[model samples]
Target: MNWETLIDEESLALLLPAEYSHFALPIKESLAVFLSRLPQSVQDRLVEEQLALPVDATLSERLGRLAHSCPVLQKLGQILARDQRIAQELRSELAKLESMPSTVPLHSIESILMQELGPLESKSIELLPPAIAEASVAVIIPFREKNKPQQPEGVFKILKPGIVQRLQLELDILTEVGSHLDSRLHDLGIPPLDYQDTFNQVRDKLRCELRLDEEQLHLARAARFFADQIDIAIPELFEHCTPRVTAMERLFGEKVTDHNFTLTTEKQNLAELVARAMIVQPILCKDEQALFHCDPHAGNLFSTNDGRLGILDWSLAGFLGAREREALVQVMLAAICLRPEKIATTLLSLDIRGQCDQALLKECVAIWLRRMREGHMPGLSWLTGLLDEAVKTARLSLSSDLLMFRKSLLTLLGVLSEIGANGFDLDQIVMCEFLRITVMEWPGRWLSSPNSRSFATRLSNLDIAETVLSSPLIAGRYWQAMWQDSIERYAVCANSR
Candidate 1:
């Protein structure tokens, strides 16, 4: 953990692409200044560097290699892959980390299982040769019940040794960076984030993801939430488990990431199923148990043999309360109706961590809506992008869960993009889901609520006849704007090519 040993040439090589090597002196000087200001304990902890690389690799190549060497970096690469804020080319490069990672040794996994399940039960269970899958957090190995070798009945999620400890170290370093940025770099015109708070939220989420016990609970909760949804599958958790080990029913399916997964069903039908699971149903469900799977990356979603969607690894699910749900519904309604004023109002009603200018928020929302009408962006992207811009320009504070929700949408979209299904009309999907919920789901919530005449209820009850009559006019205007936008986008693409 000595600083001198850790910051050697090899360790620093992965910090940037080799073409930028001339900038290394300035980077080193800046780091020296920053490290001088930190406590010795923090500096000592920071001395451990996971990245070791040759000096000639490209940025993407270095990142991919670093991700293989470090779980924390792998997680960062995964996030970067979905981040539209980053350059699309760079994001595309990082997207390689989204694929299955190399697994730890079989002996290491067995030792952990033995520790968790006791030696007897560990021996009783038969782990299939080679892991079924691997990722930043754990290795998934299919297993069979005692004396039943016909097929693997369950899967053991065995946390890699020292993974939790590694993540803890990384979180500590991240928290330090967040604190340093907030305290020392306030004048840098960075966004209005309380980085410490955001880091804390992220740390909590990572901790949850690392805990098999917590994942088990999340799976059960999500299963109950989607119990009535026939097309969704949640693998059942076995009672035999530990904090770092979980036994769950082995879902027989191919991940959407697999090359042959699309062959399970027609592309259009698969697209619909994905949209419903990742977008439509999650947003519109009125049930109190509803939760958002905050990480719907391709690795966590599958196309089952029965032509249904299978959800795996529910480690980072997000819950929205009644008020938050109502606020989101209002925001969606405003965005759909092109009412920026309402969008601003609903956004403000949610949790805000700092002061903000209401006027600036409204103006930003208006501009965002204008862009959306021009078909320049998808619904969720525009919504989150506008919010992010407002946060930077107007110093507006937003909720952590809201940020996670936005991240989930972007992640889902990124996965969809892999199969050229990125062009799915989000507007149409949201509208259909909204109408379906209004007619089929909202009535029960409305009738049971103490205030049946609330604005939400009234909005839901708006006359379908009037909407029907106005449809032609609305459709004409939208299509005209979209056609123009498409032409412009095509021109840009052609020029870029």
Candidate 2:
């Protein structure tokens, strides 16, 4: 884990693409400068041996080593692993990092657990030797209660002994590196960005993962959120739980990425189930605060034997306030209906900090609409692309929660692709969810008093007005798109015949 050893020019050459090798020098210099400011003892601890990189490692292998070196980097790797834009070889290697080998010793884990929750014997908990699973910041050790032999096995998620310190050091290093890069934006030919602010936001979210109490709260909320949905399963919490140790019913299932699991189930059904559980439900839920599972990587998701999607790891979660969710819904509706003006207005409302160019925003929305008309599916990618363009072109500053939600959506898309869910029509799924929400929630929304009407309710009213006003045009566009699709299919059929 020594910064000097793994982040040197030679290692960077192997880890980075040949075209981007020039970035190595600046990166190395930044780390060197940052390390110099730290005390010698601190630096030594930071470089403590964890996982060693192979000397003759391939590009993907080297990347994996770097990711495993730090919790922050491990998370980045998980997100990138699902990204189809990355090289398949590299993605495959990164995917392996999701189920990291247990690096912390059993005795250390035992000591921490004893300190936090007393002796395992006293609590009737039989600690299983050797951790069952390991992730970026914690390890899952399966245990059984002596008194409840008939009950399902439970898991204890123990934080790594020095993870708090290690994570803090890593965040500091990142801040320093980000500051260095931001200062060199002109020389590096990179576009303008609030690198320091972005890193700060990321740091805050990562710190949230360290608080197991908050994670427990998140788990409880998510359980209630999906209580009525039989197809989705959330881990049930046990009586003995603490900030350092979480005891929950062990989820029994195979990773969604397992080929054998996919072979046994209908791919489309499984894919739809995942989409509903991860993306659609969070976006369209009636909750006053929208709760989203920020990390949906392959390892964190499971396909259970009872045909339910088991979601694990609630440490990293995101919430969108009522107004934010309303704005987001409005933007989505505008994009789907091809209303550029509405898209522009909705986006503008979200940019509270900066002055956005109204003209530029509309132009970007129009371009996005053109792509949609050309048969581009309006899923996470299409929506994010539009938002990214708006952020860059109009200098719009969106909320951190919305940005986190976007990142989650992208990760979900990557998971979908990994599980062979890419073949499912995302647009159709989105449309179905939208219609279902409108129908099921409309009555309650209408009955609410005007004084008590939430932002979401007001937005729902606006959405109804806009839809009614533009129904003819929206119907025409859909009809034309359908007609074009039918014609294309007919031509293919004729040619085949």
Top TM-score prediction, candidate number? 2
- The number of clashing residue pairs in model 1 is 0
State the lDDT of candidate 1 residue by residue for 50-148, as single tens digits.
233455645556445545555656776786675544445556666676656446888888788777887736457777758878778888887877855
Pairs in clash, predicted candidate 2: none
Q: Tens digits of per-residue lDDT for model 2 on 1-497?
A: 34555555765554555665666676566656555555577656555532344456664675566567657778888987887755677788889877876878899988998899888789888888788789898999989999998889889998888888878877777787678778987786544555666677788888877898899999999999899999999999987889987889898888887746445247778888988888877777667787989888889998887778999999999987777767766777787786778888888889867667788888788778777877886765687888888876767777777878888877777777777754577668877877766676667767765344263333556556666788779878767766766797799999999
Assess each prediction's global lDDT (C-alpha) against the native. 0.66, 0.77
> Model 2 — which ten-residue stretch has the worst lDDT?
450-459
The alpha-carbon lDDT assigned to residue 238 of candidate 1 equals 72
Q: lDDT score of model 2?
A: 0.77
* Model 1 spans > 4 angstroms off: 1-55, 82-93, 99-103, 121-123, 147-152, 183-189, 261-265, 335-341, 372-379, 441-497
TM-score of 2: 0.84
Off by over 4 Å in 2: 1-54, 262-265, 336-339, 355-359, 377-379, 442-462, 471-497
State the displacement of the C-alpha of residue 301, model 1, in Å, after optimal TM-score superposition.
1.5
